[model samples]
Structures are given as structure tokens and as C-alpha cells.
Target: MITIQYAIIGGTGVYDSGVASIQKTVNTEYGKVEVDIAEVEGTSMVFLARHGKEHGIPPHLINYRANIKALQELGVQHIFATAAVGSLNPDYPTGSLVVLSDFMEMTKQRPLTFFEGGTDDVKHVNMDDPYCGNLRKHLLEAAKLHKIQFKGNAVYLCTEGPRFETEAEIRMMRKWGADVVGMTSVPEVVLAKELGMCYASVGFVVNMATGMESGPIQLESIGDMLARNKEKVNKMFLDIFSKTLDQQNCGCADSIVCL
Candidate 1:
């Protein structure tokens, strides 16, 4: 079982890019993760489908622990994750890309840490800047080079759901300083921090939270937005992954305690 240095956990929009070669499945303490490993621009990269290969899994049910654990086991040095979210701030209209910097978790039941077994020693992980700064820098640079319109310094709010939030719920998220709201960012960010893997999230806004849009909640519009932004998102991921793999000595690989 050889480990790869760069990995991406996303959906079919990314995994099915035909850029990656099919690889073996890895078993983790949490579950088995299927990764397609390949080389891009002379750099080795691995891509995994967060919602399974066919988008079959729901957000609330994603096996975050097993996914992160397996990636760590495979020697992944850094990670790039993409999520579909709803905009909480009116300024950030639907279909916008948000590079998340901070996050707040509103979920109560998912396992959020890796240091909680009776036999496992207690360890405290620092999370002041949860997203990896170096990775974020590379992404920002790549986005610029590609001329992709994006907003940085975003606060992502992780909510418990397979369902969209209500207008009132979205309003509370806005008050809490959240630019975007989604279901999978919490444990994903925290687990990467624990494993010391540099991680960054590229949030794709799929819709305006329920009440904010003129009409009542409509599923078709959200689907339409995702469909439209799919190409840009794919191109952005390819660029960022290629760049990070080239700059192996980025600040992302440094020790957090030294910061």
C-alpha cells in the first residue's frame, strides 16, 4: 500500500474528469474508500468521490472519518475538497465560488475528532486557521491565472442536512458571519487538521437559501446552477491540483506548532 502526496475528495464532476487512472480501494477504520490515482503534469495525484462514484450518498451520511483516515494512511500530504453549498449572504449570489477560510459547525451527532478512544491517548489539535494557508495560496494563484471569478476569506457554516435550510435559518447564519452554508465541511476540515494534512475547500454555491430567492424553494433552479458552474469548477480543480503538486515545499507542509 503506497501512499500518494496529493489527493482530492469531491464528486463525479471532478472524479470523472478522465484525468485520473482507476486505482484500488483502501480500507480504513471507518470504511473503505475508492481512489483513482494518476499523474498530472508530472505530479502524482489521487481523486476520490465524496458522494460515491454515482453521487449516491447524502451529505449527512458521508463517511468523513474513513475517508480522511484512508487518505492519511495513503500518505497524502495535502488535500483539496469541493462542496456544493447554499449562499447565506445576499452579496454572494448563487453559482459563485467561495474559497473558505473559516468554519462553524451546527451539527451535533457526527464524530468530529480522531482522539476519542478509551485506549487512544488524548491529544489537542490547534485549529486557529483550519484551512491550510499554503494550499489556499496556491489555489488563489491558480484561480487568478485561470481568470476564475472567486471570493476569498469566506466563513463556511456546516449544518446537519440532506435538506436545505429555511429562510430564517439562513438569516441566523448570516448573523453568525457565515458567507456560505453546507453539510460536509465540519469533520472534513477538522480531520485534516488532526492528521496535519494541508486542506482547502472550494465551495460552489448551488442556490440561494430557500427564502432569499423570489419564488418558493425550487429544486430545478439549484440543479441548473450546478450544471452551469460545473465546467469552471472542474478547470479550477485541475489547475490548483497541478500547482500544489509542483510546489512540494510550500508552507503547507510545515509544522503547526512552529507557526
Candidate 2:
């Protein structure tokens, strides 16, 4: 039982690539999360695929609570998750890598928290800084060291989908100041916060949302885009986890407000 304190949640096409690792199934109250415990640059890290190892799970059905809670059970404190998104902003066109600075929730019918009280006393988690600022800083710094170019920051708009958004939806979301659109990152990010874990995410712009371009959004192209950037993103995450992360006043650990 190794004490792994860092984790990576690979979204879409991102999957396991590290060597010399052991597979372990962490069973939580929510469900069992299968993870890879590996050493990257002499650092032990946990790798979990958000869409399962084979990319079998859909966005709306991902076991977010189980995933986050399993990490908590493993004593993990910091998490870095990747997502494939569609661009609504010209600056973050297809193939761009952007840091998640904020998020606009458009998801519904998903479990958004860990404390669904009745037996346990109810408490609320703060969403002021939805993504961990400290982890984002470390990630950006690590990106520099890895020579990974991030176009800029993005305000991710998460939609409940196994399908892409409509032109009208994209148009409306763009007006809402959303820079990128995706299916994941809402409940997942919030779940981590509720558990007092530092969580930050970066998105790979895989396509232009409907109406952003002239033709239809191509699924084939999205896969190819993710294939190209998967390694770069994973390497950057490993580099970030390779270094010792100290406690910061990010407020992620103090976010739970109880009555």
C-alpha cells in the first residue's frame, strides 16, 4: 500500500502510458475505481481514466463521486485532469491547449456533491475558485519546463452530453462568456473540491463548436486531435507531479462550509 498523494484523471483519448506500474482497484462507497499506481521521475502517481480505460463511459454517466472518493481513499491530495473540448472563442481554436480558469455549469441530472445529507450533516462547498489556483500555477510552470505551449486560459462551459451542442446552444453559451465547451469537468471538479483536494484541469480544443465553423463537427478529427496532444499533456502532468508540492493558501482545503 503506497501512499500516493497525486493523481491524473485522463479524459477522452488520454490513457495510461507510463511503465513499471501496478494496477489497483480502489473500492469506495460510490463504486470501484481502477487506477494505475506508477512512478514518474521517481514520484509515485495515480492515473485514472475518466471515461474508463477503454473510453467506454459517456460524459453524463461518468462516476465522478466514485472517482474522486477513490482518490481520497488513496490519500491523494492533488489532482490534474485533462479534457477534450470544442472551442467557442477564436483565440482557442481547434488544437489549442488551454488552462481551465473558470467554469459555467450547463450539466443536469448528475450528482454534484459528496455530502448528500440525511445520515451525514449537510455542508456546502465554495465555488469561488472552482479550479485550484495553486495547482494551476504549478501546472503552468511545469508546462514551461516541458516547453508546452498553452494559448491562454479558458472558461469551460460543461454540457450534459454524449452529443455535441447545437448552434443555438453554442451561441448562447458563447454570449455567457464561455470560451470552450465540453461534456465533463463540472461534477468532477466540484466533487474534488468537496473532498478538500486540490484539483485543476487543462483542456485540449478538439473541434469548433457548432456554428463556430462552416461545416459539421467531425468526430474523426476530434480523435486525431486528442491523439496528437495526449502525450504532451501527460508528460506535463508527470513533470508537475515529479516535484514536491507544498501546502498553499489555495482555499481548496478550507472550502467546505458547514452550518
Candidate 3:
């Protein structure tokens, strides 16, 4: 029965929050989610590993609905997520840390919304500022105060995975204005929007895209950037949550509307 106002959805190389914490299981209608509860200066935050604790879940196979629902049930209103992505733009090479500004979805076969003509009724969620501009501002402010070196902003493209993209796909993605590519942001972001929760994320460039590099994708070396910046990003999130958040800064909580 832990009450939390903030949650962190850790993707790809992000597993733990690097702090002392306790675990709790939240049961939702969709499924059950296990989250870590940690406190920072009297603020309670929950940490949920997007890919499971052991990285056993694939991107497309993730239970996005359950994850969001669990957080909502826990009274989580602000979500800060981490993404380990491949750099498509030359400016964002490996080890670059970028704030996610926007996102395009290439996901297929996964549930994209909570309003699936269910008892909740049909509704539409606004996507103009899908990543929660309010939280983004807080994130940047926290980073500056903590002296975390953030590279810049990036447009993330979410692809259905379990498999890396081909060279041709990478070329097409670059033309579509994608700055970085990752597997798990689509439905996760969408679900958060549907639930009217403030969600924002930081992207860690772990490697170059399929054809961007001369060689093939090396799974072994993808965590270099993640290892270096995991602590900083977590600290930044904690810092942001430790302060008083102004709900009127953006329209994130007003995203949902009846169809």
C-alpha cells in the first residue's frame, strides 16, 4: 500500500535505480506489475523495468496497458522513462544523451490505446505534446541544477522489435525525420497519454543505426552509454520529483476526451 506520485519506466539497459528501495506488486485488470518504491527527500517514486527485470520481455510483447494501469492504480501522476536508442542522426553518436522531444510510431500488432471501445468508453488522446512538455521542462531544470550533461533534444521513432532493423529500413527512417530509433516507446507513450499521465523520457544513444555504421549491430557493446549515464539520469528524475510540481504548466492531464 505504497502511495507514489512519480514513476520511472526503464528501457533497454536501465534496470535498477541505483538506490535503496523496496519492491511491490500492483494488480491491475490487464495484468500485474512489479515496481520498486524508493524515497528521495520525502517524495515517493516507483521504478518499473519496461523489459522486465531480466530483460525477458520483447518490445512488442510488453504489456503496456498493464504497466500504465498499475502506475495509475498506485497514484502515479508523473512518469520519467529512459530509452536506449540507436542514433540515426550523425550529430547524436553513441554515448549522447538527448531529451525526447517528439516521437513517430512504427509499431505493429500491439494495443495502442486504453480506449478500445471498452467500459471506459471511446476516447481520443491528444498527441501534440505526447511526451509531456511539463515534465520535460522539469527534467531539463533538474539536469541543469545537478550539472548533468545532456547533449540535446531528439525525435524518437518507435519500431516493433525483438529484431534489429535492416539497412534499407534505417534509410527510410532517417528520411522520416527520426533522430533516434528504439523498440519500446510507441504504445507505452500512447497509453500514458490515454491515461492522462504526465510522461517524459530521456534517450541514451547506444549505437549507430543498421547502415549508419560500417559493421553489423553488436549487441555486446550497446550498453556503453547506458552504463555511463544511468546514474545521472536517475538522479535527475529523482531531483525533478523531489520538488513541487506545478500541474498547470501543461495540458498533459487534459489529453483525454470523449469521442
Quick one: best TM-score, which candidate?
Answer: 2
- lDDT (10s digit) by residue, model 1, range 1-259: 7768888887435456557486768898888988788877776777888888888988778898998898888898778888877777777777688899999989977888887757665566677768887778777887787787786567999988877788888888888898888899889988888887888888887777777877765556655666566666666766776653543544444434421
Worst 10 residues of 3 by lDDT: 217-226
Per-candidate TM equals 0.89, 0.96, 0.96
Residue-level lDDT of model 2, residues 76-178, one tens digit each, is 9999999999999999888899999999998888988888788776799999999999999987888888888899989999999988899999889988999
**Model 2 TM-score, 2 decimals:** 0.96
Candidate 2 wrong stretches, greater than 4 Å: none
Question: 1-259, model 3: which lDDT tens digit per residue?
Answer: 6568899999887876788889998999999998888887888889999988898988889999999999999988999999889989999988888999999988889988777685766788889998988898887888888888778889999998878889999999999999999988888888888887889989988888899989987667666757778988888888888888766888888887785
Give candidate 3 regions above 4 Å deviation: none
Each candidate: what lDDT? Answer: 0.77, 0.89, 0.87
Best by lDDT: 2
Clashes of each: 1, 0, 0
> If ranked by TM-score, best first, what sequence of candidates would result?
2, 3, 1
lDDT winner between 1 and 2, please give it.
2
